[model samples]
Target: MLYREAGQFKTSYAKDQAVFPIIQDRWFIALVLVVAYGVVPLVANEYWLQAVLIPFLIFALAAIGLNLLTGYAGQLSLGTGAFMAVGAYATYKITTVFPEINILVVFVMSGFVAAGVGIVFGLPSLRIKGFYLAVATLAAQFFILWLFNKVGWFYNDNPSGTITAPPRTVFGIMVAGPRATAEVRYFISLTFLVIFALLAKNLVRGRIGRSWMAIRDMDVAAEIIGIRPLQTKLLAFAISSFYCGVAGALYVFAYLGSAETEAFDLLQVSFPVLFMIIIGGLGSILGSILGAAFIILMPIFLTNAPALFNLPMPTDLSKHIEEIILGGLIVFLLIVEPKGFARLWQIAKEKLRRWPFPY
Candidate 1:
């Protein structure tokens, strides 16, 4: 009954087109924001902020980036980690060269750098697609990582060959580097995620989004109807990389604080993010967050479940079990609900609205 929207009448086109048409949804979202910005920071300690929430937000942003391309635009990319590397390296270069600039601006500019590289790699999509396209992006993954590793300039010629985020402040508050507390890092990441997520939500609802979807659903038909495939597809690549680039910056600066090329490896970064969108739901924004949370928290739960139950499971054994369970869950979701968790959430809401009567 609480979820019912029976009397929330839309008197205008804007009301009808609102992001959250149901008053309940709007209130729920507001409450979530309140908790994220207000309560979480006040109560959460280093462990909660560092181990779970930070990574969850970062991966959610990355998953959203992948979904924009693979889900909405019907393009396959295996170079997400590469784009992220570009962002990280680009941000490092900019920060070192101009020490006085705001870190947030540097993050945005790094995304643009990654977007340029994405456009270059994305040219292959114009001619080839599906498995072939995946192969092309996979090559990008290897090549970009190699370039970063071999080039002394990217790492600033540090003997360790790893990049570290220099101390940075936002409005006099430390938010990056070792001196920045977990709470500060959490807030900065949360702010970026909220802003980018809103931007993505609006973008996917507007003309450009429609064009991408047109190409995704049926490129030949979309072109026939005047949607230029070249422009739409390239735009998707650019925007997707931009988001990934920002995510990469946050991953290093806000979460990890320091990282090397191995930090953005294919298995560690790319595949997991790809799985996030797949398990969460393609073409759905909420799915990205849900997927990231699930992926990030599942292992933690697995690691702790044995202790909670007083079982004598070894750590290595439990890790292997976690992998098995994750793979199984993916297969199960594929077989039973290919639309993924977001669809399940929508179905539940629909059912609640019609409770006490058969549809």
Candidate 2:
């Protein structure tokens, strides 16, 4: 069989201890990266790139952050929307105040704001669990959004109840606001996604990851085993929010160029991202990306399907079909694989490993 690995052998410890022991898996990941960063831009039109791909990428990034907390660390959060807002508003202020800084710096610095807010909201997680902790996050959502709304200074006297991202240039190329090109933002978002994803992969595979997983599986057991519950939980919150912050910065500076109250609504946070991670898989980063893409593009396709096929779907019925598809996909995924897309991915990899050698 062309895909057989029966004869493969590892000699050195380092070679045997690698993340992907199989050569095919390593090549598969490399192929995916090449297609995502290289081949995609060549074929996709601006509408596809901006409307579908960008949203999918950024939201997947946010979902990955949330997955780290809710899925891995066992902290239930309903305030992901609030953390995203903190990032958006923080980016607005940083860029406007200096007006000379690199856009990359703003993306990174905005994480601090989200980190602070995440910590504050995370305080209640120590005392509460399940629905009570969820309620705590709800409080954070309302309070943080209110602070940004009523506080006129946060709006920068723009009189729009929003922040307009100024023109941003990366390495002397315009990459923000209306004048920015789709390709520029695509690359920027792609770069940040890659960097942070690598960091998260490392973090989750290391000691901190062990602690989070322990806490997730059972807090009491984790505590008895010497995992400090408070510190581990707080670190999850901080890192998770930091991911959201960078996503928020990109939302304004790269994609939208302006954001308002609706940008970080609970529905925006809980549904798109929360659902993405849940449907994709709780603990797998690849599942986050797959879920984000599936969630982001499905509705758009539903809306545009009629036009593409020359079929007449009433506007209202089209909307209903969109909802139906979403609901059905969730139900289908739940039924097909209770463990989620990650579990399916595992099954596929195993099948690849045992190709042409079925028991």
Candidate 3:
């Protein structure tokens, strides 16, 4: 298993502590990267790649951002949606203002903006922890969404209060707005996702990540061990926000083409992201991707199930069944494993590695 270092030799502490010491894990990751960055893009259908896969990647990136704060750092955040909006609007403004500027650059710029706002809201965590901190984050969720909706300038003077995606290209290739092709968008999204996810994985394994995990397990002990709670928490917020920002930019540029403030409402944006982290397994990057995929695909698969099989359409019945199934899955996962879906995955992988062996 990637998390284990069995039958491998380490001459020093550094080698022992390497992120992936086992040959099996290294090969497994190599194979995965090959499939993700190679095969999937080469052969996937446009509809599957665009509508479903791209959105799943975006949400997974967002979930990884949330996981860093809540799962690793032991702080709660309910306002990722708000931070994402900052990414969206800030990107919208920057791109529109500088028509000649590169669209890809806007993605990084949005992250910087969202990171600033994320830190401002994250400041409250210095004094509060647990539920109180989560409540404070909720204030941000509503306030920021409202701020954008009320401000006409943020919407670029659109009558419907939604910001429309302007047509843009990179290297003369269409990659933004409606005219962009699915394969083009998929590769772009995958490029960033792979880069950032690797960065996040490295972060958690490094000094910063250890500090967060220490803080999560026991703040008092971590403080005694010289981990600066305030400094570390703020860093987590900033970096976490950075990931959310990029994800937000992708949503508009690659997926939505245009977005409304309503896209980030508390019930729609905030809660679903929260559920993804919860269901995906907190503190695990791979879990975030898996969780986002499961949640995103559930409703889609449900709606299409009847049509896919040519079964009688029950309309309301299918919708209700989906709601029940979603709710039940969350409840069952929580009661069964409060640590989130990541833990279950850890167990599964361990079992796979230990197959044909006894405890």
Instruction: Give the candidate number with the greatest TM-score.
Output: 1
Of candidates 2 and 1, the better by TM-score: 1
Local distance difference test, each candidate: 0.92, 0.87, 0.87
Write candidate 3's Cα lDDT for 228-310 as tens digits. 99999999999889988889888878888888877877777678888888888888888888888888998899889889899
What TM-score, over all chains together, does every model reach? 0.98, 0.96, 0.92
Better of 1 and 3 by TM-score: 1
Prediction-by-prediction clash tally: 0, 0, 1
What is the lDDT ranking, best to worst? 1, 3, 2
lDDT of 2: 0.87
Candidate 1: which stretches are off by over 4 Å? 356-359
Model 2: which ten-residue window has the lowest total lDDT? Answer: 1-10
lDDT of 2 by residue, 115-170 (tens): 98898789888888888998889998899899999998887977879999888787
Residue pairs with clashing backbones, model 1: none
List where candidate 2 sits over 4 angstroms from the true fold.
Answer: 1-5
Write the residue-wise lDDT of candidate 1 on 109-193 in tens digits.
Answer: 9999999999999999999989899999999999999999999999999999999999999899987889999988888889888
